[model samples]
Target chain A: MSPLLEVRGIGKRFGSVVALAEVSTQVSAGTVTCVLGDNGAGKSTLIKILSGAHRHDGGEYLIDGDPVRLSSPRAALDLGIATVYQDLAMVPLMPVWRNFFLGSEPTKGRGPLRRLDVAHAKEVTRRELLDMGIRLRDPEQPVGTLSGGERQSVAIARAVHFGARVLILDEPTSALGVKQAGVVLRYIVRARQRGLGVIFITHNPHHAYPVGDRFLVLKRGRSIGEYGKADITVEELTRLMAGGAELEQLGHELAGYGDVTALDGPVKSEDEQP
Target chain B: MTVGQDAGGPVPAARVRGMLARPEIGALIGALVVFVFFASLSEVFRSPAGIANWLDPASTLGIMAVAVAALMIGGEFDLSAGVMTGSTAIVTGLVATRLGWNIWLAIGVSLLFAVLVGFLNGYLVMRTGLPSFIITLGSFLMLQGLNLGVTKLLTGTVLIRGLADVPGYHSASMVFASTVSVFGGAFRVSVLWWIGLTLLAVYVLRRTSFGNWVFSVGGDVRAARNVGVPVVRTKITLFVTTAVAAWLVGTITILRLTSIQANSGIGQELIYIVAAVIGGCLLTGGYGSAAGATLGALIFGMVSQGIVYVGWDADWFKFFLGAMLLVAVLTNQFVRRYAEEAKR
Candidate 1:
């Protein structure tokens, strides 16, 4: 089957600087496409282009093999594209149900007399979260009360509930601890299992390695490498991501010159260096 | 599940239980205390006649208070709202009495102007992305100038008069400002409008999709937009709604007195804002209630009228108002902190 979303030769520019240059990727249903990058590697720019926040200066975006233009975020949403940012994309003071039903709230009446059906919204919020295996302490509790990991889960579940076929998460686990990151990785897997195409953006290869089906590494706004899960081992991926030779040079520099005991251990192991 | 294992587990009934234990509780207590304080000070305050009297002012303030609270909860302010009333009233009076237009037609025209002003406020704020305080402050000054300059030019005086002689004036006045007998004493028709508007606002805020948007827009506009909420449109509509409320209040005031003063609604905007904040609306937006605003208005009315019944100098009203504002804001801040801490 064709992939859910396809980006071909997409490039974006901000004034004089090139934020992205000819980045291309494909996201398939039931798979996590990890876009790994360091800070300022144009991860945000790429996500914005994908989520319809910014238009690519040059590119072809296809949904089901038909070229499309997303003029705005609303346009992207209509096309079943949902992007969850690192902040969890929610109002802190609103109840979970209200946050869930914020944008596309269901209405009962036809026109001026139309009103929100709170009961229905609440029911759906509960059912949707439960279906995603996320149990909230109280649906009425403000989302601010939720932990960092739980908030990301809610945003993920929200995208799923809204019928998003492609889920683009922007550094979803960047601010989280090891355990919290694990929880989010679990949800990414869950979303993928439910047949939704997930684009997981993160800097940590360890966090992405477990659930990622395809890995695309970005360095300074360009795709440095793309590999399938079976082709790239965790150690190789980490070495490449950490800039293997540069890391070794830095380690060597940090070691006290020619002092065996001061160097802590071996300067270079046979298998460790490139 | 054991309490330890369920430490972060879903608390089945905790939401409602938590609500009762927090800021909502403080608001309820404050409302009751104000009610009791007024009731004990004045014998008439406990009677139907006193209820009608207090409710009259309460209703007028209630209508504006509710709208202001909604806007405040959405994280914006309409400084022009108070003077916009004067502007609308002057427009209606000048058109009906001086221009010889039908009273209803004049009212419609006046409302259109009010809507335009509201649109301008919303449009400018959104377009410029400035703090609404600065934008609405500019609007307030511009309208104040227009209200004074235009009324003076049209009427050759500071006040526009002769509205009582305009065609359909009596019926319009009866509908908009005349008294209705509720128990023994007559209650202002505006009071009925206020209560009806309050109910409508409550329904919109609590039970409707629009209410959800209001909360979301106020809570976090970027988040709301990211999730596909129409942030700009929601805010624009809110501004328009607030202006319309101002027009209604102006119509009631002018028709009741059969005259319009250029400065009639001057200085009332802050009171509406104060009432809204005291009623539990966050100045930063994202949390509030229309009923809370209405109750806040009631507190204002009770205090405003209660001072007179207790035989105190009316001059002290300003001092009382300042104190109420300070105390209410301080209380609201404490409650907000409590809510935030409780959420953690």
Candidate 2:
């Protein structure tokens, strides 16, 4: 089968500034595609292009081998392309169930009497969260109270439940602790297992390495390379992402400030220290 | 699925606590306290006739307060709501008395004007991206001026009277103004209207997708828009809802009094907002209840008249209102925090 989503030589520019140039990637069904980049590496520009927040100025974007143009976020959603941004697109003060069913609320009754199926909504929210191994004390509780990892999970589960064929997660664990990041990684794998073409965006190579089936690296506005897991190693990915030569220069510069003489004078015997 | 480890579903008691932590709970408690306090002070306060007398002002104020509460929850404000009331009242009275139009026709004309002003306020706020406080303050001043200037121009006086003899006056009054007799006490029909409006508002806020949009828009506009909550339409409708509420109260007032002063609803906008705030609405938006707003108006009704029954100075009403507003906002802050914290 053709890849679920493919962007070949996709380019975008704002006036004289080239945000993304000659970028290419493919997300196949049931596979995790990690888009690794540092800040200003055109990760956001590429995500915006895919999510229809902005239309790419060059090249072609194809889904199921059919070229499609998405003019708005709604247009992206309609095409089953759900983008969970770093912010998670959640109303902090709204209840969990309400946030769960916000855009496409399920309804009962008919005509003017049709209303949000609150009981059904709450029940499904509980079941869906439980399925994802998230145990909330109360679904009625405001989402603001949820920990950052939990909110990200909720946004992911919401996208999954709403029939997202292509899930683009923008730095899902960037704000999380190690354990929380682990939780998100598990959810990412779960989405992949459930047959979504997942685009996991993160600057953290460690977070991306374990779950990613394919890796795409971006530097400035161009693609450095795309590799299947067997073709690349984590150490190389990490060095390239940190700009190895630049980091080595900084390391040498930092070593000069260590001051061996000052350190030697600081040592003292046990009794003489007082 | 691994919840048997340690994490389990919420306990029944926790769920009960969650319910109690709703944004309106504080306002509900405040309403009960005010009711009991005033009831204890005046023997006449509990009387059926006294209840009817107090409920009259509450019905009108409650109508506007609930609308304002919804708008506040949708993350906007209408400083013009009070003057819009007066402006619509002027339109009704002038059209009926000066233009020799049927009372119903005058009411229709006034409603159209209300909607126009509402749309204008909503449009300007959305288009300019300024705070509604600024936009509606401008609307308030202009409406206030138009009310006085237009009434004087048409009626040769600041007040329009002789509406009692207008065609369709009886039927219009019967619908909007006539009183209902219960237990040998007469309560204005507006009371039922208030209750009905409150029920509708509560239902809309609680059960509908539009209600969800209101909460979403208020909580975070960018998030809501990203999720396709129709932010602009929801907010615009909320503004229109407030203006339509003003028209309703204006209709009830002019029909009951058979005349309307150009200054009829002047300065009352703050009172409606105060009532909404007293009902636990956040000034920053995203949390409130229509039922709470109605109860807030009820507290206002009780204090505004109950002071007379107990023979205290009526000037204390403003002082009491300000005090209630501060206390209510403080308590609402606690409630909002509780709502957020209870999950953990």
Candidate 3:
């Protein structure tokens, strides 16, 4: 069968500036497609196009081999494409259950007597989180009290529960510490195991390597390469993401600065001390 | 799925954190402390008669404060809410006493007028994307001017009276100003309206989907919109609700006194906000309770009169209000800090 979602040779331009060009990637069921890019490398522009916030200027965006154009983010959502941005779109002061059911809250009764089904919402939130292996002591706790990793996990679980077939996460773990990021990475794998295709976007090659089934590297608004997991290693991916030969050229240029850094002592001792 | 892993993070002070997380607990405690302190100092202050006396004003202020708290929770403010009460009162008095209209119809006209002003305030705030503070401040100034200029133009004075001479005045007063006898203490009908409205506000805030939208919009507007919450409609509705509340207070006051001053509620807006903040509403929004606002109004009523009952100079009332506000804000800040420290 066709892949769940695919974009081939996608390109975009804002006025005379080329935001993205010749980017190709595909995501199939139960797989993770990691888009690796540095700042201003067309990552956000590509995400906007994929999430239907902006229309692509060229190439084909297909779902199940059916070429289509998404008119808006709502349209993408209706087609089972959900984008969980870094902010997570949550009310931190609200309880977990309330945030979980925020936009599409369940209700009981009718007319003037109608009210939120708080009991049902709490039960579902607890059940869904439990199903995802997140056991909270109380779902009534305000979301602000949740750890950063746990908050990301909540957003992921929310997306999955909302029937998202293709999940596009924008730097989901970037704000987190090392172990916290590991916690979020585990949730990405959890989403993959549930048979949803995930487009995981990040600049960190280490974050992308362990969980990624495929990698698409972008540099300066252009795709450097796209590869299967076996075709690339984390070190190579890192170098490529940082602009391979350009990194070497920059190292050569900064060689004098490196020598001056030796006088700072800690610049030379930074690696071993940490 | 991993089992028995981190499970989020540490929640060592669960019980304390849980209580503080309610936000209204501080207001509730403060109310109780003030009640006991005043009651201990003055026998009259604790008596049923004194309770009725203070509750009368609290009831009216409570009605308005609860509505203001809802708007505050929705992340906006209606500065005109205070003057809207006066404006609505003047409208009711003018129409009933001067237009030869029935008191009921006059009340209806005032309600409609208040709603329109509210809708305008909300619409401008939403359309311009300006801060509600500035927008509502403009409305407040305009309403103040209208209250004085219109009243003067119509009656050649800044006061509207003779509502007692209007048709249906008796019936209107019976509903709004009539007293209920309970344990030898007579409470105004507005007191019941206040209590009933408070309970309703609490139910709407905690048990309804619209209430969720209010909190969501207040907490973070962009985030709420991303999640599909109707931010504009929720905020507009909150503004309209506050206006309706002002209409209620205006109607109650006019019917009872049979007259209205152009500036009766001119500066009362700040007092309503004080009551709301003291009752647990965060000026920043996204956190508060309707019950807390009502209790906040109750504290205001008790203290304003309790000072007089306990033989203190009434000049200290404003000072007492300022002091209470600071104490409440500091207490709320502390509680909020503890509530969010659960997983830190």
Candidate 4:
């Protein structure tokens, strides 16, 4: 099948500083394209370009094989490209339903007589959240009260319901704890299962390896490597991300803490074999 | 999703309960208490005549309060709103009574001027991104100066009179200022206008898509814009709406008195803001009600007029007002905090 989105030779610059250079990636429906990077690794710049908040200095972006220019976030949204940032893009004090329908409110009647369909909005919010396996204590409750994971889930559900073809999530699990991260990962999988292309951005290899079909590792504003699931192992990906020399040095430093008896026994052979 | 397996069930009623737990709930209760207190103290307080009397002031103030509340909820302030009324009234008076224009034509010209001032306010704020407080304060001072200087220059006096003699004044004044007899007592036409405007404002705030944008932009401008809201247009329109309300109030005041006083509405902007705040609007924006503002104006009218009915020293009214304002704001702050907390 054709890719849902494709970025060719994308580059971005701020003044004299190059934030991203020669970065290319493809996102396919029912697949997770995990973009892995540490802080200041050009992930934000790349995502901003993709979301149309910033224009790429050099690139051709294609949606379903059709080249398009997105001059604004609204343009991106109109093309069915939805981005859910870490802050979750919601008004904290507003009810879940209100926030869910914030920018694109449903109206009945016509012209000046048109009114917000509050009942329909609330029902749709509840239904959509439920469809995504999210349970709200109250649809009327302010979104700020939900846990970080739940908020991410709500945002994901909103994008999906709004007919987003590609969902770009920026560190949805970074602010969450272990169990919360697991919850969000589940939703990411759920989104993919529903045949939506998901770009799950994260730095943690273990987190990405579970749901990611392909991984693009970024470092210092450049893509260090791209790996398919069959081409890399979790340990090798982790070592590559941590820098092999640094990982080796850390292992040597901690080797003194191992039990001498176990280290000298069959465990040594098992380690050597791997 | 299976019916029994659905994790999303009916949300608890406690969300609204959380809102009720807010300090503003106390103010709401206090408002009720004050209403009952005044109603019980005087037989006239419960009468249609008394209601009309209080509602007349409430209507004028209500119109201003609703607009102020909308602006406040949008996270801005307009200090010139009071003096803007004087300016608009003077425009109507000069155009109709002095320049010999038809009353309707004068009103149209005056409304245009109001819209211009509103546009200036919105444009300056949006272009500069400055706090509206300072921008509108400048506007307030300029309009105040214009009201005094222009009126003195034209009429050789601080007051412009003889508006009653203008063509169409009789009919226009009747529509704008005269009362209709309801329940055997004349209720000021402005009172009906106030109620109607309040209802219209409520519909706009609660039912329209524009209302949603207002809340979102007021709540978080960055998020609202990211979500595709036309923040600039909404805010500019709000400023214009406020100016139009000021024009209406000015028309009623000038028509009723057949004269325009240079300093008539100079200090009243703060009162409109206070009534809005007391009614449940947040100073930081994104949360409030037009109905609440109307109710807040009613509370003010009751306290102001009720003091006289109970035969109390009128001097005490200011003290009472100050206490009410302080208590109401403090309570509303608590309500806002509680509501935010409950959402978390």
Candidate 5:
């Protein structure tokens, strides 16, 4: 099947600074496309461009093989592109149902008497989260009370429920604990199972390796490489993510002071040269 | 994490506790305590007549407080709200008495004036991205000066009169300022207006998409915009709501008294905010209730009139307002903490 979203050599330049250049990726429905990069690697810029926050300065962006121009976030949303930033786009003091249906609340009645259908919102919010395998004590509870991982899950479920064809999550697990990261990763898998193309952006290869069907690496506003699950292993992904030979050199430099074996990293010593 | 393990969901007892943890719960308790204290101290304090007396002040203030609470929840302030009352009344009285316009027509003109001022405040706040405090404070002072200067200029004095003899004055007064007897105790029609306004506000805040937008914009404007909420429109509407409320209070005061001073509603902005805070509104915004603000105004009415009914010095009213505000905010803090407390 054709990819739900495909960007070919897309570029964005802010005056003299090239924020992103020659970045390309494909997001296929029912699969996870992990965009892995460190800080300043243009991961944010790429996501912004893909999500229509900023107009790409160069190259082609396609949806279902049709070339299109996205000028705003709302335009992107109408095209079935949803981006979940670290903030999760939730009001902390608002109840789960309120946050869930915000900006698009379901309403009943008519004219001046029209209002949000509270019961319907609450029911759907609960059912949707349950479908994502998360059980909240009360959907009426303010979303701020939910753990970071749970909030991410809610955002993902909302995106899926809202009919997103491609979901872009910006570092959904970076601020979470191991177990929490595990929880969000599970939700990401659930989203993929729901037949949505998910762009899971993160710096952690370990978090990306298990769920990501395709991996695209970014470094300094450029696409370093793209690989399928069969083409790259976790160790190779991790090594490339950590700047490969530079990290191998740092590991050897610090090797004498610590038990490097206890590091449990798969970074191979063979990657380093004398 | 420990709490989410229950597949059966939270127990009824815990659920009840959760309800009690709300900020409004604190205001409700404070209101009840004040009612009892005043009732015990003075025989007339709890009487139907006494209730009428207190409800009079509360009715107008409550209307303003509820609107201010909505604005507060939307994360802004209208310091000029009080002065707008005086300014609007001046506009109405000037048009009716001086220009010989009908009272109702004068009121319509005043409403337009209030709306324009409100739009200006909101527009300036949005366009300049300044704190509403600074923007509205500027408006507050400007309106204050305009109230005194324009009233003096138009009428050659600080007060407007003869409204009682103006065209449509009697009917306008009957609707806006007349008294209705409830079981032999006369109450200002504003009390019913206050109730109706509170009900409408609570419905809008709790059951409408606009209410959800209010919370979102107040909670985090950037996040709200990212999610496609119309942040600017929501905030501007809030300011306009407060201004319209000021118009209501202005109409009530002028029609009821048959005259209005240039200084009417002066220095009452802080009182409206005080009532909101006492009713469980956060100064920082995004969390408040209309019912809470109504109760806050109720407490204000009780204390301001309760002191006089019990033969206490009216000078203590300000002191009581400050004290109650402090207590209510502290109580709200504790209650909110309890509400969000995770269980093992």
Candidate 6:
């Protein structure tokens, strides 16, 4: 089947600085595509393009195999592409229900008598979150009170509720603990099960390895490699994400002090020269 | 909304905690304490007559504070709000007394003037991306000069008078300045207006789509925009609301006294802000209530008058007000911290 979202050789430039270059990936419905990159790996720039905050200077951005140029974030959203940033777009001090329906809040009455339908909003918010398998004790509680994982889940569920066909999560687990990361990953799995296309952006191989059907590793402004789950193992994915040869050399350099076992991966053991 | 464990039933303790989480709880407690303390110390402080006197000042302050509180929650300030009152009054007085226009006509002209100034304030803030404090401060100073210069230029005096003799003055005054008899005490009509506006503000903030935009924009501008909230329009309306509030107070003042001094509302801007803060508005924005602001104004009225009723030096009023503000803010912060920690 044709991919829901396909970017071929997508690139962005900031004046003389090449922020991102020739990055290629595809997101299909009912699958998770993990974009793995370290800091300054053009991850943010790529997101900026895909989320329509900026336009790619070179390459094709296709929605359902049809090329299109997105004008703004609003346009991207209209096309059913939603980006849930790490910090999220939630007002922390606002109630969960309020945050859930902020821009598209439901109202009752007409003309000057129009007002937010509080009962309807609260009921829908509660029911929607419940449908996503996250049952909050009270929808009236400020979103700041929620755990990190819960907040991410809420954001994901919010995008889903807003009719998003493709959800791009920016570093969803970067600020979370192991258990919290696990919680978000479970939600990602649930999203996949719902037949939504998800683009999960993170630097953590361990977090992405189990959930990801396809892996796109970025180093600087270039794509290190893109591999399907059948083409690579977690160890190989981890090595590529960490700059495999550089990490292997660093492992030898720091081998005498502490255990280098953390970086020890399925790096080609026969490359003995460097 | 149930407030217990993930799968459990309701928790009574959570219900109490929820009540405390309201933005106005601290202000409510402070109001009760102030009432009791003053009532015990001075018999006149809690009397019908005394209540009437205090509520008058509170009524005016409440009007301005509620508007300022809304603007604050929308994530901005209007230092020009105080000067705006005087400016609009001067405009009304001049148009009527100098040009011999109808009193109602003068008021309409002043209302328009207020809206223009408000739009300018909102526009400059949005366009330049400058802090609103600086923008409004500039407007405040400019309006201050204009009020003085224009009055001196036309009237040859520092104040405008003879508004009472103007056509339609009597009826206009009746509407804006007349007293309402309540509990055998003649209360200023502004008191009714104050209550009405507060109730209206509360409804708007709690139940309207615009209110949601206010909170959303103030809480997180980037996020609000990301969600497609019309941020500029919302904030600009808030500014205009504040300016119109100033016009209302100004109209009340000039009609009641039949004159307005050059510096009638000078230095009163901070008081409105202080009232908002005491009433449980976060200086950071996105978390406040109009009812809280009204209570804040009421606290101001009671304390300012209660001290005099107790035969205290009026010189100490500012000091007392300052101390009250600090205590109120500290308590609010402490209670909020406690609530958040307890929730966790």
Write down the DockQ of candidate 3.
Answer: 0.47
Q: Which stretches of candidate 4 lie over 4 Å from their true place?
A: A7-24, A53-61, A66-72, A248-274, B1-28, B342-344
lDDT of 1 by residue, B1-344 (tens): 11121365455544543764233354566668867987897888778898888788888899999999888877799999999889999999999987899899999999999899999999999999999999999999999999999888877899899899999898899899998787887789998898899899988888777888898999889998877788889899999999999999999999999998899898999999988877878788888888888888888887788777778898987787777668767876765554443221
Say which candidate scores most in TM-score: 3
Report lDDT (Cα) of residue B56, candidate 2: 93
- Whole-model lDDT, model 1: 0.84
User: How do the residues B131-222 of candidate 5 rate in per-residue lDDT, one tens digit apiece?
Assistant: 99999999999999999998888889999998999999999998899998887678999999999999999999999999999988887788
Ranking by TM-score: 3, 2, 5, 6, 4, 1
Candidate with the greatest DockQ versus the true structure: 3
After superposing candidate 3 on the true structure, give the runs of residues whose Cα lies further than 4 Å from its correct spot: A249-258, A264-274, B1-10, B339-344
TM-score of each: 0.88, 0.92, 0.95, 0.90, 0.92, 0.91
TM-score (0 to 1) of chain B for each candidate: 0.92, 0.94, 0.96, 0.93, 0.94, 0.94
lDDT of 6 by residue, A125-181 (tens): 888787667877678887776767887888888899899999999999988888778
Give lDDT for model 3: 0.89
**On residues B207-239, what C-alpha lDDT tens digit does candidate 2 reach at each position?**
999999998999899999888789999999999
Residue lDDT tens for model 6, B239-260: 9999999999999999999999
Q: What is the lDDT of residue A147 in candidate 2?
A: 66
What TM-score does candidate 3 get on C-alpha atoms? 0.95
Worst 10 residues of 3 chain A by lDDT: A129-138
lDDT of 3 by residue, A42-79 (tens): 99999999899999998999988899899999888888
| Every model: Cα RMSD to truth | 6.0, 3.6, 3.4, 6.9, 5.7, 5.9
Worst 10 residues of 1 chain B by lDDT: B1-10
Query: lDDT by residue for model 5 over A24-81, one digit each (tens)?
Result: 8899989999999999999999999888989888999999999988888888888899
- A78-148, model 4: which lDDT tens digit per residue? 89999999875788767788889988899899978899998999899988887787766457767766666
- Complex DockQ, candidate 4: 0.31
**Lowest-lDDT window of 10 residues in candidate 2 chain B?**
B1-10
List the pairs of residues colliding in candidate 1.
Answer: A116-B208
Among residues 3 or more apart in sequence or in different chains, the pairs in candidate 2 whose N, CA or C atoms overlap within 3 Å are: none
Candidate 5 accuracy as TM-score: 0.92
Interface root mean square deviation per prediction: 4.0, 4.1, 3.9, 5.0, 3.5, 3.3
